[model samples]
Target: MSTSLDTTRLLAALENVAVISTTDLQGNITYANDLFCKLTGYAREELIGQPHSIVRHPAVPKAVYKDMWDTIKAGDIWTGIIPNVGKGGGVYVVDTTVQPLRDAAGNIDSYISIRRVINDLMQNFEAVEFSKETFDEYYAN
Candidate 1:
């Protein structure tokens, strides 16, 4: 049987392992967790106040972002593997989940995203030629 302490410790470890961030309704970064900053090669200050799109790779299909925004704004969760461009053109990929966060009154307030790096998986996908059609299939609910 797991105690509260065990649950707390598990979440703490998970937080450390995950790259996380929160963005306000306007899509500007509100919080950049340490792992997010480290993985993206950006200082926390550089990320904060910037659009969350700052990390998006140019080649990422626009439809993907559109779908993600539509899903999260409607208070649903969106999950997919995303290719991201880091500071100075560095590249990385993450299995990402973005969801809306609610305020005390149960109104949507902001969005929180949690991601796990999947560089190897993305590399394999790229080797097979990831395409717009494939992306659309992934975006399908």
Candidate 2:
């Protein structure tokens, strides 16, 4: 018989602590925790096998994700704060990291993104100014 420390429980534990969901190369959701569902307003069935971009918010500058994709595709870890729109059209923020998973041949086979809800610190004027300066430098604004 299997113990409580089975694969499912381990995954559940990871979900309990993880802030976001994990996806495959096709952007299909493979694992999503309760926090993810709550944050995105998406049910498990609605998210699994669905593209992660479904939660992309219009307010978010596309350049951010462009950088993220470039980094992850290069087999690097991407860390940033992302703006996402919920199913109800409500806006939210998350401090996110996208890490690439490699297969036996050391080829990237998937991506795992961990994210945690962040307060709207950008709503502050100073934060906005800092963001403008930083992003301007990053994207040559």
Using lDDT as the measure, the top candidate is 1
Best by TM-score: 1
Model 2 Cα lDDT, one tens digit per residue, 1-141: 755588878877877766667889877888877888987788988998988998998878888888988999999999998788889988888889999999999999999999877655656879878888999999984
Q: Where does candidate 1 have its weakest 10-residue lDDT segment? A: 121-130
TM-score of each: 0.81, 0.73
- As a TM-score, model 2 comes out at 0.73
TM-score (C-alpha) between model 1 and the true structure: 0.81
- State the displacement of the C-alpha of residue 6, model 2, in Å, after optimal TM-score superposition: 12
lDDT against the true structure, per candidate, is 0.89, 0.84
RMSD of each: 5.0, 6.7
- lDDT for 42 in candidate 1 is 94
Mark the regions of model 1 whose C-alpha exceeds 4 Å error after superposition.
6-8, 123-141
